[model samples]
Structure formats: structure tokens, C-alpha cells
Target: MAERRVSAGRRRHRAEWLRWGSLAAAVAVVVVFLLSQGQDIDVSYGQSPASSDAVAEGGAGELGDVTVPSVDEMAALVRADDVVRLPGAIASWDERRVREAVGDAEVRILVAPPGLDEDERDRVRDVDDATVRVIGTEVTGGIYQASADSAVGWRAQFAVGDVTDQMVALIAQLRDRPAPEAVDQFDWRDPDEAELAAVAADLRATGVHVGAGATLDGIPEDLAASAFPDRRAWYVVLPRQPFGEPVPRYGPALAELFPDTPVVVVYGWWIEYHGPHAGDFDEVVGASFYAQLGERLSLYDYPQRNVLAGYLARVTDVRYAGLFDRPLPYRPFDPLRVALPALPWLFTACVAVYLVLSARPLLRRSGAGARTGVNARLAGLTALAIEVSGLTDVSGNPSLTRAIGKLGAAGEALARNLPDRHVRSLLDDAEAELDDTARSLGRADYRPDSYLSERLA
Candidate 1:
């Protein structure tokens, strides 16, 4: 009897030590995480390999083995003989740096426009091979061209049945001169002479170079001569495949007449379709239509600027100048990665400790633990409500608080042998609150007071 008692006591003592020790370890880890958190990855753009490796290591826990090369590393990819392609809109070229980088080598600047047919693309390719080496998808090239001929570069007058207010104002501003001239309109379906005359007058009043769609006879020799009298290059906007026909074969004439001067042809009607849209922003970002190296490093706005800077740095044997716009913030290391994986074991330990400590009281009044059980049930429902409703941190919801309180009260009543109707009523009210929250989340009405949390929650 004495030996058995001693063995039992030792087992209890060992079990007690383990429960407390496990709880202490978990608490210590959580406390340490809270004390040292919110650290961000520090990325040094073209810093040394060691610094780049540090950035890679910083986010290794979150991103998992993703390593972004530094600007210096990317610079090594560009060869001296490679033609650096740039978007025409980007004018922030450091002339000295460009000259120093490539010496006498020439680079291509793309100006592809929208709705470019295969034939048009081929023509552009011919031009590109001679000048710019065209490489990229149709959409990418089109976006590159669109950025080149942004609103600021509009010089030609366009006439359509439904013209935007911006287009009208742009036409007026571009053509408005000392002498009143008419801007011609061609109503393709009706072919209204009076309406066309009126539209022409309105456009000409602003001193714009308006075309009278009178003769599609190969862009009248006189108009060509008049337009390019100085024999200088010009980015001209031509009518869309005159009279809904295919683009006229004017390349031969254009090349012959302006062999010495480069004439870039743009579509007058293309602007009508390119309006403010979600996809436009993505296209612009993908176009990369600016110098890679600039004062600011924005891949969306100016990829070419950075590329140029990188090229210059490579050739000049100078360090990359433009790295990042701002310094990155510091972040704390997360222990959750380790804790989450061992959650089952940790939870089991916690429950064992709780049952062991409260075993006597639990045995005396089994219903005493029912309130904790009820709270746990309510907490689960509240979590579901939060997840479905998209709430960030809803700690002070009156309806939710009332529901939880009623649930606790019902649990106490059940403990005293009361009826289950009170619990049913509380459950109904909680369900109602969840339904209301879901309804609010689904409403799509756009109002000034509408917010993500309010609507979703």
C-alpha cells in the first residue's frame, strides 16, 4: 500500500510540471511575438549581394524562397550591342548618359496604335526593322503606341457622330487660329452635306487643320506638299480607312515624298474607343513605355527610365543611381508560422491543464462548466458572423453582445432545470442578426455613406 501511494504521487507531480511548463512556453512565445512585431522587409535596390540576400531572408517566412534580383544584377543581362526599346512618350532621357552608354548605336522607340490590323502591323514591322525592332504581343505594342500618342500629343481633327466632350474641346484647342476654317464631318450612314458643313465650320473656327472628305484621291498631292512644306518629320493623324474602306496604299507615296523625313501615321478614330476603363491601367503598366531609369522608379509609369539608367551604369562602370523612391520600414519576425503548425498539441495541453486544475469543482457541480461551454458555442457563432459579414474587428456590436448575454443566461437557466424555449429564442435572435448582416453585405447601392465594413458587416 505504501509503495503504490508513492508511485501515484510521483506521477501526479511529473504531470503537474509538464502542464505548467507547456503553458509557460506557449505564453512566453506569444508575449515575445507581441513585444517584437510589425517589422517590414528592408529592400536595398542595387545594394551589395549580401544586402539583397538579407532582403530575401527577411521575407522568407512569408513569401518562401522568393528572391528578387537587385538592379545591379538585372543590369548584367543587357548586352552593349542590344537595342534598348523605349516608349516614345518617355522624354526624361539623360542625354549625356544615353550617349555615354551606347555611343553611336541607335535604339527603337515604339508608337503602335489601337486596332492595328495584321497588314498595319506588318507595315509597322517593316518600319520597325528599318528603325525600331518590333518585339512584343499585339496588345503590348498597341498599349505602347497609345501611351506615345497620349492626349497631349493630339494634333489631328476627328469627326464622328458621337464625339466626347474632351474630344470636342481638344479639336477646338488644336485648330483654333486667327482665321476661321471648317472641320469636315462624314456621316457614313446618312452622308449629310449640311451637317458635315456645319461640323467643319465648328472645327475650322478653332484654327484646326480640318480635312474636307471631298476626295479620297490619295491624300491630295497639294495637301501633302502643304502639310510637309518644311520637309520635316511629322506625326500625322489620318482618317480611318477612308469611307469605311481598307487603309489606302499611301505608304509608297509617303516614303517617296518624305524619304528624308520620317512620317509617323496615327489613327484619328482610335481615340474614341480608348476611354477610362479598368483594363487601360493594366495595359499602360504592361506597356513599359518610358525610359527604364528616371528620377523615380515606377515600373508602371516609366520602366524605360530604369532600363536606361541600368544600361548607362553598366557601360560607364558606375553604380545604379535610381534605386527606390523611399526607404522600406522594419518588421518583426512572426512566430505564428511555428505556433500554427503545433496548435493541436498546444490546445490539447491547455485542455488537460484546465480539466486537471478544475477536476474537483467540475465533479461537485457538473453544470458549472456549462456556462464556459455556452460561451464557446457563442464565440463560434460570432466567428461565423464575422467571417461571412467581412468585419475586421467587431468587439462592440450591441446586437451581438445582447445575443451572447442571452445565450449565457439561457445556459444558467438550463443548469437550474428551466425550459429550453429561452435558449431557442436567443438562438433565433442571433440567427436574425446574422441574416441582417448578410443583407447589408449584398446591397450594391453606391452612396457617399457606403463603406466596405458597414456594407459587408
Candidate 2:
């Protein structure tokens, strides 16, 4: 009968454990399912457009009443105007520099940048377009890039060829080409009213009408569709860091957005590493940009810049790199989970240890290990340690040290003479204060409150 009872208890214990384990597994599955339920989004970059669609399309009509300004005409206009809105960089327009560039009139130029000095403030005309305007140093293949990401990141990059007839022809063609699908709008509210009007007038004079509601997508779609094939990307400098150091974030921005157009991102140091310092040339050298989507681009060596451009084209050679609107992929918890698998193991180990420690008290069943008075023994040892270790002046307690010292001496004597007997035999510590208090209370005539105090008094 005892053996049968023991078997029945074992079966019940096993069933209880299985129930708890099943519940824990169910909770884990629910948690993982909830976490994985979200939608996925990602974009693959560097695919090429189909070869059939590779040809540049055009609906480029005549350059109507507005005469196509030759590169020199635009250059001359830039030199002669009172407030010249020439497309150039933020850094290239210091007060003394812009003043010199304008030559005579009290010239002021404004750009979309974070900081400028008191003298710099005096020079800014206004910040109408936040990205940038383009200006070419010399390449007939679209040279200047206009970055429009933001004040901190990469801005728009557009071509500003040498102020030449071919450059003018290209500009006219670009102006007439259809724009792309609408882009997110840009808010153009300048704080200063006068500055706004002046910039408005400058754009108007150049024949590019500034409609009141014009946004970043103001340029018609046809224009963009026409330039799809021949457009060469350039490095458009945007804002710098705390101290005027240029770091553009546009290549990644465009790489993520305008996957159709191969955009390039190059930094200043890249050029510094290759050849002669840019400072030696009296003119501002154009930045070399790259697009990873094109067939591996190779740069032309003569002017030295085309070499960089060439390299960009060659690398982005795969198809679909030029697709404008494709889905971005889903990526989450990859790096974190891969880098630290130990976190889950550590968490599980702690839980298991806690369950084991808690279940220890309940393990005193038929075949379970002996229910040793582990806690009671621990408490006894702790009390004994305190009685021995405390200073003689421990408040509200007296005789504790004396009794403990006598016990220690008795223990030493036992070790020497009666090695086999317990130390309690010699100490004669037959009375425990707590046990005596209980015995005293058990007696019929006990009064804890009144008699104890009176006796002490």
C-alpha cells in the first residue's frame, strides 16, 4: 500500500510539472507571434533600367521668347547684376568673396545654411531654395549639383555646365523636358518680406517663373523624363558639421528615393587623397559624385573628374537599379538577435534557478530528499555569529558577549580533552532565553507586562 501511494504521488507531481511547462510554452508562442505580425518595408538599390528604356526621351520644344543664355551670357549676367543669384556653394560666398564676385553693387547673397557671421549676415540676399543652386566650373556634361535633402544632409544636385552655348542648349532642353511624378512639397516661407520679394524678382528675371504655390516639384515632369538617359550626377555640397567641414548624406538619400537616377556621393577628403590640393587652383573644383545603381561607372582622366564619374557608371550596372518606385524590404531584430544570443539564455537560466530554489521547500514528499532544517540551522548559525561578532557595547543587549566568549573557551577545551563530544556538554548552556520565556508564560501565574517590569525595576 505504501509503495502504491508513492507511485500515485509521483504521477501527480509529473502531471503538475507538465501543466506548468505547457503554459510557459504557450505564452512564448503568443509573444513571438505578436512581435512578428507587423508589415515589412525595404528598398533594394543598384539595379539598372532595361536597355530598351535606356534611350533619352524628349518632348523638348523651342526655347520660346526667352533667349537661351550662353554660358558666357549667364556668366556675364552673374558678374554684372546688382544681386546676382548665381548657382554656387555656401562656403564660396564669404562677404569679401561675394562682394568681389559682384564687383560693384552692395551685393548680398543668401543660402540655406545653419550659420554665418555678422559680416556673413550682411552678405546674404535670402534663402528661397533650401537645397542649393548649381554652377559649373567647366565640364560641358552637367557639372554643378544642387543638393536638397536638408540643412544637415545632402541637398539636390543638378548640372551647371560651363556658361557655354552647348550648356545653354542643355539647360533649355532640361527646362522644356517633362518633370517626373510629383514629389513631396517644400515650404518656402522666408521670414524677411523684402528678401523674399528680391529673390522672387531674381528668379523672374531669369525667365524661370516663380509661381506662388511652387514646390520642389514645380519643375514639370516632361523635363525630367527627357533628361533620364544623359544626365550625369555631380557632388552638390550641402551643410557642414560644427566647424565648417562638409559631409553630405544625399547619395544615400537619393539611393533610397530616386532609385531611377544614379546619384553619387563624394566627400572633400577623397579628392585630397588623390592628387594636388584643391586650394592651389584659383577656381572652385567640382566634386565627383557616384551612383551605385549604374554599370560600374569609370571616371574620365583628362580633366581628372570624369574618372570619378566613370567609376560611378560602371559599378551600378545591374538592371532595376534605376527603378523609380520599388518596395523597400523588411529588416528588424537581425543585428541585435545575432550579436547577443546569450541574453535569452541568461534570462532562461535565471528563471530556472528561481523555480528550483522556490520548489525546494515543497520537495519533501515520499521519495524527495530529506527535509533538512536548512533555514532553521542557517538562522541558528546567524544568531550565534551575531552574538559572538558584535562589539561589547551593543545597545539594549547585555551578557550576550560574555556568554558567547564562555562558549568559545568551552569549545576549545572540548577539542583538546573530549574531542568526540559536542561543545554544549561542557558549556552547560541548558537554558535558552527564548525557551525560558515560553516556559514562564506557560505557568498559570504569569503576567508579562506588569510583573516583568516590576521585577526589572
Candidate 3:
């Protein structure tokens, strides 16, 4: 009896090993198949690698040649009714709809012809005092200018549909602007002494020197000394009213004032930085700021404290955190490549789990009962496999039908002798299922149900 028990134990161990080995083999096959199907395996996400030179060059001198109104003319038109439509800029029908869309909002809509020449863009940029200027043209689609001195024309450009549609969408976005919870006001032009001091304190708290004045020349000596000590990166806040000119005028002027030192100039609704290290600001930080600003103007429209704090955070990230130092990983939109590799493994896992669960009853049995259960399951499975194979024509072929029925009967006979009630019931179920499948396949007029037909039912 002791020797017999040892033999049974060894057999069970071998069976477990065989089952696990089969699962590992299946997994290996799946991996090999997937690897063979594709040459390159990409497991990355986001934008592709961008060259430093391309980022540094930026999108500065790309304006095409197109006539636009002079600065004085554009300003007069903006001052007239906040809707400036150049001759032949848009169709009469579109112009009427655009005028209705403007409908007394503080926003100015400038409808220019398709292409905006360099001179024209500069002239349009010169119009200094409008709250929000939207230039709709066939060439650039839509240009959203927050201020006249905007270093970058159109914080966000929309080219979807015609110029008319773009202008209407731009106007709607500004009119229905959602106020941010952090900002209580949209006026930041002339912050009082206390407000300036608060903004200065906030800037200094973030480990950067802060300087504030009506103009760059008027900044306090002590504040200027601290902010620009040793010609390093610093922050300067100026009132929107003082800089009556566009950023192209003051941005380079400040850059010359403090040569080699990185200077961030913050005005209400406008932020510009200059220095050798400020290229990333133009490439990454500026785009990020404008994108955020376009969504919620409050970032720049709010008080200096909130706006400067937000600007400082972005500046610090680009300067120190190596935000754009590495090229972002890109995953292409090939659904087949991504989904195909995962399918075989998923199917194998499910089959493995089912096999283990179904074999549990057989594994629990000992000696002759175990053998009986195993034989019964094998016979039932063999019949089911043959029925599934669709290799033999069992329909109208009485011999093939008899063969399948006989296999099921043999399994049932073997199951009857097993002491395990669960194993006996499982074998019985298998026999019934196999019989049903055989009968279904045997019918001459049978048709399979389609996905749509079943769903409708």
C-alpha cells in the first residue's frame, strides 16, 4: 500500500508539471508569433523628437505678403465700433453675420483679406489699446491678439472653415470666457504700491529677484540691483499702459538694456523673455502660456501676483527641470499592431484558467477513480474536438453520427464508475453538450446565427 501511494504521488506531480509546461509553451508561442509579425515594437507615447535648432529658430519670420490697413486707419476703425472690416476682406453676407456676432462685446474684430503681408501685420500689431483684437483673414484663418504690443500675433490661430466662421468662433470664445476661481478681477494695468509689493514678494519667495516699476528705467535702484545681481535670470513687472508700443519695440530694447542676462518682462495679458537661454521660453514656455491663456485669459488678465506667479512657475520648469531637453516619445495610431500582440496572450490565459478549473476534480481523485475520470473527460473532449473540427460530414452520414454517439456513451460509462459526484456530473454535462453540437451540425437545413440577427432578437 505504501509503494502504491508513492507511485500515485509521483504521477500527480508529473501531471501538474505537464500542465504548467504546456501553459509556458503556449505563452512562448504567442510571444514569438507577435514578435515575428512586426519589425519595430513601439511602447512610447506623446510627440516625436524635435531638433534644438528648429526649436531655437522658432516661428518668427514666416509672414507672407498681403496688404493690410495702416496703424492709424486700423486704430480709427477699432475706435469707431470695435468692428473693423477692410474692403473685400469678407463677403457681404459674412460681414453682416460677423457684425451681429460682435454685438457690443469689448472685443475688436479685424477682417482682413487672405494674406497678411509683413508690413500689414506690423501695422495691425501697432494698434495698442484694444482689450482683445481678433484678425480674421483667408491666409491665417483667425488671429486672437490680447494686446497691441503682443510679441506673438494671435495667441491662438484657428483656420477651420472660412475667415467669417473663425471670427464668429473667436468672438464667442471671448464673450463666453469662464472666469478662473483664483482670479477675482480682470484689471491688472496699474496695480497700486501695495499690489506691486505683494507681487514682488510672491516673485522673491520663489527664489528669483523681482523688480517692478511703471517703466524699466523707473525701477528702484535697490530692486534692480537685487534682481539683476551678477547678470543672472530675473523677473520684471511693468504696467500695460506704460508700454504704449508693441513687444517687438520693448522686448529687444530690454534685451539690450541687460545684455546676456535673462529678463522676463510681464505686462497685463503679455509676457516676453529675452537672453541667450530664453529660446526654450519662446519654443515651449510661450506656446504653453498662450495655449493656457487662450483657454482662460484670467491668467494674464488677473492681478500681478497671480499672473507673475503662474509665469514664474512655467519659466522655472523650462529653465531648470529640463522640460524640453529630451524628445517626447511618440506612439503611432496603428490599432492592429497594439491589439494583435495582446490577443493571443489573453486567449491563452483564459484557456489556461479554464483547463485548471475543469481538471481540478480529476486531480483530486486517486488510483482507479482518477484514471476513470481522466479517461471520461478525454473521451468527451475528443468527441467535442472532432465535432468542432468540421473535417468529417456527420450530417446525412449515419456512420459518423454513430461514431460520435458511441464516444459519448463510452465516456458516460467510464464516469458512472467514478466515486466523485462532481466529476461524474461534469462528464455528464460534456456528453450532453457534445450530443447537442453533433445534432446541430447534422441538420441539413441549419444556418448559423449572425451577430446582427442575434442582437436584434
When 2 and 3 are scored with lDDT, the better candidate is 3
Comparing 1 with 3 on lDDT, the higher-scoring candidate is: 3
Give the lDDT ranking, best first.
Answer: 3, 1, 2
Compare candidates 1 and 2 on TM-score and give the better one. Answer: 1
Q: What is the C-alpha lDDT profile of model 3 across 31-103, one tens digit per residue?
A: 5554656667555343222212321111322232346667887778878866566753421125665576667
Q: Which 10 successive residues of model 1 have the least lDDT summed? A: 293-302
Residues 103-216, model 2: lDDT tens digits = 342322222121222232222322221112222211111233322222111111211111122222333333443322222221222225454344335333541222232122
For model 1, the superposed segments whose C-alpha errors exceed 4 Å read: 29-286, 289-352, 357-457
Q: Identify the leading candidate in terms of lDDT.
A: 3
Find the candidate with the highest TM-score and give its number. Answer: 3
True lDDT of residue 360, candidate 1: 26
Give the alpha-carbon lDDT of every model: 0.33, 0.29, 0.45
Q: Tens digit of lDDT per residue, candidate 1, span 200-229?
A: 353335312223432112222333332233
Clash total of candidate 1: 27
Off by over 4 Å in 3: 1-5, 13-212, 215-233, 241-263, 274-284, 287-302, 314-323, 326-428, 431-457
- lDDT, candidate 1, residue 59? 27
Per-candidate clash tally: 27, 68, 2
